[model samples]
Target: MKFDLTEERQMLQDSLRRFLGDRYTTARRNEIIDSETGMSAEIWSQLAELGVIGAMFTEDQGGFGGAGFDIAVVFEELGRAGVVEPFLDSALIGGRLLAEAGQGEKVEKVMEGALHLALAHGEPGSRYDLNHVETTARDGVLTGRKAVVMNAETADLMIVSARVSGDVADQDGIALYLVDKGTDGLTIQGYPLLAGGRAAEVTLDHVRGTELFGADKGYQALADVTALATVAQCAEALGAMETATALTKDYLMTRRQFGRPIGTFQALAFRMSDLLIEMEQARSAVINAAGYFDTDQRDLYVSGTKNLMGRAGRLVAEEAIQLHGGIAMTQEYELAHIAKRIVMADHRFGDTDYHLERFIDLSAA
Candidate 1:
C-alpha cells in the first residue's frame, strides 16, 4: 500500500510544520512548561485558528478528516516540535468519546479549542488494563480515584470511567460520565510530568456527573478510544524517532575524531545505517496500523504497531543520546527533549511487553 499522505493531509502537515517551526521554539516550549498552567492558551487558540485541532475529528464531529491518517499527520507534527499542548487529551481521546456519546456541541467546542477535556480512566494499580475499572458509579454519583490523568488539572471537564455493576476487570458494566471541574466532592492534585506535560491524580467522592451514553455502552467506547490513542501515540513516537535519528546523523558528520568526521568511521556509519533501517520499519508499521484502523483487524494492527514502536523508540532514544555524547544530556538541547518524549511515549497506553502480550493473545485466538 502507498504510504504517502493525501494532498489535503500533506497540506495540513506542511502548514502545521511551518507554524510550529516559526512559533514553537525550544525557549517558548520551556517557558510554557514552567508556567503555572504548564501550557499556553494563546498557543492553543492559535492552533485552533489554524484548524489543527478540528482536523483530528470527522465532519460529523466538526472536523473534515477524522481518519487514522489525519490523526497520524497532526500528531507526527506535534511530536516533531516537542509540543506540550493537550491536543491529544482534548481532541483525540476526549473529543472522540464525546462524539461517540452524541455530545455534538461539546465536541464542537473541543474542536474549536474553546474547552479542554481529559479521560480519567487509569487507577493507581490498573497497570495498562483498559478493563480494570475500580471506580464506581450509581444513581448519578461517582466515587473513586484516577491516577496520572493527563491534563486533568487544566480540563474544564473530565470523562471518567467507572463500574456500574460487574466486578473490576470485567468488560461489561463499565461506564463513562462527564464530570465538570470544580464540582463538589472532587479533588485534583496536579504535578508536572517528566516529559514536559502536566498530569493529575483525581479523587471523586460521591461526585455527581452526567452520564455520557448508557452505562452498558461504555466498555466498547473506551476500548475503541484507547485503541485510537495508542495508534496516534505510535505515530508520534515515529516522528520523534525520525528527529532523533537525523540529529544523530548530523552529529556523526560534524563531531570529529582522529582529525576526521566520526561519520567517516566504519563502525559509527554502520550503527547509523542500522538506526535508519529500524526507523523505516517503524514507519511502515505506523502506516499499516493507520490504514487498517477502520477494518476488523484494527486492534491487531494497533497492538503490533505499538509493540514495534515501543521497542524502536527505546533503541532510537538510547542510541541517539549515546552517539551525541554529553550535549544530548542537556535540557537545552532539542535532542534531549525529543528523546525523552520518545522513551516516555512507550509507557503511555501500553508498553512493549504489554502490547506484545496482547498481540500474542490476539494472534493465537
Candidate 2:
C-alpha cells in the first residue's frame, strides 16, 4: 500500500504551499481571529478564485475534478499557514454533504463560491457519535439543538443531521436537511474557540427545512463524510507536526545556552527524534486512509489514521511549546498559533480516546 503522491499531486501541493506563504501571515492571521467572525471574507474569496474551495468536487459542479487527497494536500498547506478560512468545514465537510445528499442546486451554489455552507452534526447528547443525533425533523419542521457547529455565522446554507421521528439507536433513521440561514425560529449563538476557529450553538424551534438526503445504504454517508474529513484533518496534523518540529530544531540550533546550542543536548535531540518517528508513522497512516477511503475497509483505515495522527498532532504541539519555553505561549509567536490549532485538531472529528475505542471496535468487527 504505497501512498506516494503522483507528479500532479506534488505540483498541487507545491502551488498551495507557495500561495499560503505569499498570502497568509501571522499578522493577518491575528487580525482575522480578532474579527467578530474570526475569519476573513476577502481571503476566502481569494481562495475560491484559486479553486481551493472546489478542488475536491466533480467538474459537473464547476469544480476542478479532484479527489479527497487533493483537498487533503490543500488542508496541509492551510495548517502550515495557521489559516482560519473554514476551508475544511465549508469545502470538505459541507460541500461533500451536499454532494452526497444530491443537493445539486446547493452544491452548484457552494462550488461557485456564491454561498458558504456548514454542517450541524454535533449535539450535547451525541458525545462525538456522528450518527447519534437527537435533533428531529418531521412535517417540514426541525427541532433540537446542535453544538460546536463550525462556520455557522458566515454560512448561507446549513446541512443539519437529525433523527427521523420515532427512530431507533444505531439505525438508519438519521436524515439530513437543508435550511437557509436566518430561517424563522432558528437561532445561532457563536463564539471563538480556544483555537483560531469558531463554533456555534444552533437551536431550532420548529425550524423548517427541505429534506436533502435520507437513509441511503443505511445512512452510511454520515460515516463516510466523517471519515473523509478526518483524513483531511490527518493531512493538516502532519503538516503542523512537521512545521513545529522544524521550527523547534532551528531555534535549538541558534539559541545557545551553556556555551553550546541546545540541540547538542542529547536529551532534547532524542525527544525530537521520537517526535519525527511518530510524525512519519502518521504521514503513512494519513495517506493510506486517503487511498482506502471509498473501499469497504475504509472504517478500519480511518480509525487507525485518526488515532495515529491525533497523537502525533498533540505530542508535537506540546513538545513544541515545551521546547520554546514561555515564549511559545505568547500570541506574538507563530508557534503559539500552531500549538493552539493543533490542540483543537486533536479533538476535532474525534479525539485520541475516541479513535482508540473506534479502532478497537472496527478491528473486532
Candidate 3:
C-alpha cells in the first residue's frame, strides 16, 4: 500500500537520470531515430558498458543482480529523455525470457556488454494474446509469420514463441525458442511506422532453433514477466505525459495571443490544470502498480496499472496535442516526440480495451 522507492531504487533512478543527461539529447535522439538502422548501436553499447542493458537480470543469469523495479527505473529515465535504445525489447522481453529459461551460455555471449534482443511473438492474426501463437515449431523447425515485431530487423537474436503440436490458442503447448538473426528461411521486411520508429514482418519459413523454454508452465513466467513489462511501459507513458504537459505549459507561457501570455487565459489554463491532475493520477498508478509487481501481487495490480496508464497516457497525449494546436502534429516540433511515444504506448503489451477485458476476466474468476 505504501508507495515509496527504496534507497537502491532511488539510486538506480538517479544513475540513469545522470547517464541520460550526458548521453542523450533531442538532437542525438532525432539523429539516431532517423538513421539507416533506426537505432543507435553506439548508444546501446554504451548502455551495456554501464551495465544497464543487463541491469534487470540476476547474478545466476550472468547479470549484475537486478530486478523488475530496476528495469522500470531505467524505462522511466529513457522516457524522460526520449532515448530510442532497445532496452525494453532486448533486456525486458527477450533477455529476461532467456535468463528465466536458464540459458546462461547464450546470455554470457549475447548479453556480454550489450542487450538488443527482440521478441517475435506477435503474428498477423494473434492480436495481443501472446498465448495465441500461430507460429509452429515442430522437429526443430519453426514456420509462421510474425507481424510488427519491434527491433526484429536489427536485433542480434530473437526469442520467439511458437505453438508445439497443438491449436494456437492452447496455452499449455507453447514454447519459447531462441533464434539467431539472419538464419536461413528467416525473411525480414522492415518498414517505417506512423510514429517514425521501425518494426518488421518476420516470416519463418521452416526456420530452426533450439528450444529454450517449453510447456512447463512457462506461461506463468511469461505472464509475470509481461506484467512487469506492462508496468514499466506505464511508467514510460507517464513520463511521456509529464514531458508533453511541460512542453504545452511552456508554449502557453511564451506564446502571445492578444496582449498577454496565452497561459494566463482562464480556459487554456484550466485545461492545462486538468491535464496536470490527470498526469499525476497516471503517475501514481504507475508507481503503485510497479510496487505491486515488486511485492508479488499477481492478479489485479498488472491490469490496474495497464488500465490507469492507458487512459491517462491517451488523455494526456491527446490534450497536449490539442493544446499545442497545429504545431503539435508537425514533425518540426518537439511535442510530436512525446505524442508519438504516447501513441505507440497502446501497443506496448496491449491496448486499453484489451487489458480492460483481461481485468474483467480476472475479476470474474
Question: Best candidate, lDDT-wise?
Answer: 1
Residue range 1-365, candidate 2, lDDT tens digits: 55677776687778778888887888889989999889888888777777677676767655765476876777788788888878888877888878876677777777667788898878987777776878887876899999889999888888888777444355577888889999998999999988786889999999998887775432577777788888888888777777888889898788889999988999988987888888789778877787777788888888888888778888889998888788788998888888887777877888889999988998998
**In terms of TM-score, how similar is model 1 to the real structure?**
0.98
Candidate 3: pairs in clash: none
Name the 10 consecutive residues with the lowest summed lDDT in model 2.
163-172
Models 1 onward score TM values of 0.98, 0.95, 0.93
lDDT of each: 0.90, 0.81, 0.78
lDDT of 1 by residue, 232-303 (tens): 899888888988998899999999979999899898888899899999899899998999999999988999
Models sorted by lDDT, best on top? 1, 2, 3
Q: Select the stronger candidate by lDDT from 2 and 3.
A: 2
Q: Choose 1 or 3, whichever is better by TM-score.
A: 1
Instruction: For model 1, give the RMSD to the true fold.
Output: 1.0
Worst 10 residues of 1 by lDDT: 210-219
Candidate achieving higher lDDT, 1 or 2: 1
TM-score result, candidate 3: 0.93
| Candidate 2 clash pair list | none
